[model samples]
Structure formats: structure tokens, C-alpha cells
Target: MTVRKVLIFGRFERFWHWSQMVLIIVLMFSGFGLHGFHALLDFELAVALHTYAALALLVLWLFSVFWLFTTETWRHFLPTGRGLWQVLRFYTYGIFRGERHPYRKAFWRKHNPLQALAYLMLKVVLFPLIWITGLLYLFYFLWRDLPHASDLLFAVAVVHTGAAFAILAFVFIHVYMLTTGHSFAEHVAPMMTGFDEVELTPEEEAYLEKDQPAMIR
Candidate 1:
């Protein structure tokens, strides 16, 4: 199979990915401190840092949402029913047997069925849940006049803490999955340079050739 270097990520895509990664790391560290897991930062300082990081994340998300809609790259995240089982089998059994990957990367479709579903869940469900609960926890004083303010605040804190831990686990899993590519550099380098060496099927090659002029612009 001929492998070719193709542009997979764009400049803004790379920027958003790395910036989000950094902000999430900062948020996690300060969140742990605030939760009394360790004394990395003073409680008040941790709260301030976490709030700032969360706000920055929100800004990045807003920009990202606009970019996705404008570029129509959101289609890349739509889950496919065609290869879900094959992808799951490849991960669970085929990979151990040294079988080929069931899914291939392409310019229009970067994610396999499982990846698309996971990312969609993170963006549409987990992210919103954490952000909403975190905001509620932060502004508890504003709702202190409510009859069950104390209980409500406690519930919000619990949800926020739980979601933080869930995000932390996902981060570790994401890092581990990066090494599963052709080489660690093959996957990680594209985020740095916006190109990846990928194998193209005959149909994909023909499609690329037909759209070559548009792709260049």
C-alpha cells in the first residue's frame, strides 16, 4: 500500500487541540487542589485559577463551535453505523492478533464509528454537564435565598467533582491511545504540522484527484 503525506489538520485545528489540552491540564491540577486531594496551591488561589481556566475553555469552545459550523467540519464527528462492530472487534481482538485496522483515515472522515460516538458524547453531554454544574457551584451565593440552597449547592458540588474525575480518566485514556497509531509520531506530528502520512484506497485517491483544485484552496 502506498502511503502519502496529506494535510489532515488545519492551523486552527492544531491550535485549538493543543490549547485545550493545556487548559484541561491546568484545570485538573487546580481542581485536585481545591478538592483537598493535595496541597499544590492554596485553596483560594486554586479557586481563582480554576475559574479562569474554565472561562478560557469556554472562550475556546465558542471559537471552535463557530469554526466547526463555518468549515462544516462537524460532519467528521457524525457517528457511522457501517463500521462500528468491525472497529470494536479490531480493538478488542483483532489488534492482539496483529490484524489490520478496520477503519482508515481520510480527509473528510478522520474518526471511526467508535471515536465519533465517544467524541460526540464528550462534547454534547459530559462537557455541558461539567460546565453547568461548575457554574452553579461557583454562583451558589446568588441562589442562597432559595429554600433548599444548602442541599442544592451540595448536589452541584458532587456532580462537578464527579465530572472532573471522569474527564481526568478520559485524558489518561486519550494519551494511551495516541501510542496506538502507526508510530507515536505519526499521530502526534500531524497536530504539530497539519499533515499525516496515510494510506489511501483507490476510491479515496480518485476522489482526492477530482477535488485536488478545491483542496489546494
Candidate 2:
């Protein structure tokens, strides 16, 4: 078996990944403060910071959406459903017995079946819920002219808070999964350097070499 260092992640991908991670961390911190869960920051200060960070995240998401479509990198998140059960079993049971991964990374596909589905849901469902509810909560004043505005705002707040907690849970799981790579730094180093070392079978290597241009583009 031969291991090769491949440029799996591109420059923009690295930038977006790290930037989104930082923004999410800031949002989580400020969000908890606003929820009165802690006193790290004053209520007013926390509100201000949370709003700013959320807006910045929205902007980043917009640019990222455009980039994903233009580069067709969105294909990476498409669910193939193959080996989904095996992947889940590997994580839940097999990994404890030191079994190998059911799915391997490819030049065109970075995410496993479970990862692709989870990330797709995060982007299409969880994120939209939080963003839309946040907007309604933030601009309640403008919608106050409508009937039942107070109730609407309250519901939005409830959903937004719930989504925030869900995202926080996801963050914890994500951090833990980072250590599941070949080494502690194996998964993380690529995000910083845009390259990853992967072992490939002969057929896989041949396919990757032939499809390199399509993968990069």
C-alpha cells in the first residue's frame, strides 16, 4: 500500500471552514450569555456581539454558497447511501474493537455517507431554522404592527434557542470525532494546510489520477 499526500482541501475551503468554526464559537459563547446561562459578558454586550457575529456568519454563508455552486463542490455533500450502515457500525461498535473505517476518502468525495447527510441537514435545515428565527426575533419591532406579533416572536425565540443548543451539541461531537483520524492531528492538519495524506488501492489511485482535474475544478 502506498500513501500519498493529496491536496484535498483548497484554499477557499480552508478559509471558509476555519472562519465558520470561529464564528460559530463566538455565537455559542455570546448566545449563552444572552440566555443568562452564564455571566461571561453583560446582557447588552452579549446581545451586541451575538448579533454582529451572526451577521458575519450570514455573509460568510452567502459567499460559501456561491463558491460551492460555482465550483460544483457541493457534490461532496451528496449522499450516496452506500456503506452507511457499515460506517455507523464502525463508529458505534467496530471502532471500539479497532476495526478499519468502512468508507475511505476520495479526491472527489471527502465526506462519508453519515457525514454527508449530517452536514447537508445542518446546511439545509438547522441553519435555516436558526437564521430565519433569529431574523424574526431581531426585527420584531417591524412586525409588531401585525396581530399576535408577541406570540410569534416568543415562538421564534423558543425555536432559535433550541437550535442553538442542538448546534452546541454538534460542536462537541465534532470535536470528539476529530481525534478518530489516523492521528490526533490527522483530520485537523488538513484544514490548516489544505492537504491530507491518504492511502489508496491501485484502482482508486488510477481513478483519482484520471479525475484529478475534475476534482480540483
Candidate 3:
């Protein structure tokens, strides 16, 4: 197999990823504090941090959506049946035996089938759930005069908190998957440097070389 350095991530994507991660961590801390899970900060301070972090995360999300559509990269997240079983086997059985990954990076596909499916669930389901519940909670005052506003607020809070926990669970699984790479840093290094070794077909190699040469190292 030929391994050559190819650009896989863009600068803006890198910025968005790390920024989102930090903001989520901040929200987690402040959120737990606000919910009386910890006394890391005063109530008012925790509320301020959580609110600001959520707002910042929302802005990042908007930019990411724009980036996804404008670049036509949303197709990358579309799930595929190909290689799902191999990837699952690799992680479950083959990895410990030191087998190569079942999926390859291509000009068109960067994520494996399972990863793509997870992203779909995150973007289509969890993110919207969290955003809607969170927004309703944040702007509760606008609907405070509704007949059962207090009851609705309680429901929104419960859903928002549940979604936060779901996100945290997803993060844990993602982090654990990082170690399943050839080396612990094999996956993460690409995000940091925006390039990684990929086995490119002749057509992809030729196209990147001719049209997007900067992507080939």
C-alpha cells in the first residue's frame, strides 16, 4: 500500500473543533455547578459561564453548518454500508492483533462508515434536541405568561440536562475510540496538522496533484 501525506482537515475546521470542545467543557463544568452537583463556583458565576459558553458554542455551530453546506462536505457525513463490518471487527477483534484499519481515506471519504453514522445521529438528533430545549430554557421569560409556563419550564430543563448527559456520553465513546487507531495519536494527529497519510487511488492522487496540490505534502 502506498502511503502519502494528504490534507484531510482545513484550518477553519480545526479551529471549530477545538473551540467547540473547550466551550463544551466549560458548559459541562458550569452546568454541573449550576445544577448543584458541585460548588466549584458561586451560583451567579456558574450561570454566567454556562450561558456565555452556550452562546459561543451556538455561534460555532452556525459557522460549522455554513461551512458544511458551502463546501458540500455534508456528503462526507452521509452514512454508507461499505466497510462497517470490517471496522467493527477491527475494533472488536482485529485491533488487538494489530491489523490494518478496514477503511481508507479517499478524496471523497474521510470518515469510516460507523463514524459517519455517529455523526449523522449527532447532527440530526442530539444537536437539535439540545438546541431546542436549551433555547426554550434560555428564553423562558418570553413564554412566562403561558397558562402552564412553569410546568413547561420544568420539562425543558429536564430534557436539556438529559441531552447534556447524552453529549457527554458520546464524547466519552469518541475519546475511547481514539486509542483504537494504529497508534494512540494516529487519528488525532491529522486534526492537529490538517494532513495525514492516505492510500490514494491514481485518480485521486492525480486530481489532488493537479487541482489541489497544496493538499499533497
Per-model TM values vs. the true structure: 0.90, 0.90, 0.95
lDDT by residue for model 1 (83-109), tens: 999999988899889888888776678
Residues 47-129, candidate 3: write the lDDT tens digits: 89988988888999999999999999999999888899998898889988988888887767888899999989998998888
| Displacement of the residue 61 alpha carbon in candidate 3, Å | 0.9
Per lDDT, the best of the predicted structures is: 3
Please tell me which predicted candidate would have the highest TM-score against the true structure.
Answer: 3
Q: Candidate 3, TM-score vs. the true structure? A: 0.95
Evaluated at residue 34, the lDDT of candidate 1 is: 88
**Global lDDT scores for all candidate models:** 0.84, 0.85, 0.89
What is residue 168's positional error in candidate 1, in angstroms? 1.2
Q: Count the backbone clashes (under 3 Å) in each candidate.
A: 0, 0, 0
Stretches of candidate 3 above 4 Å error? Answer: none
List all candidate RMSDs to the true structure.
Answer: 2.6, 3.0, 1.4
Span of 10 residues, lowest total lDDT, candidate 2: 208-217
Better of 2 and 3 by TM-score: 3
Which residue runs does candidate 1 get wrong by more than 4 Å? 1-3, 198-217
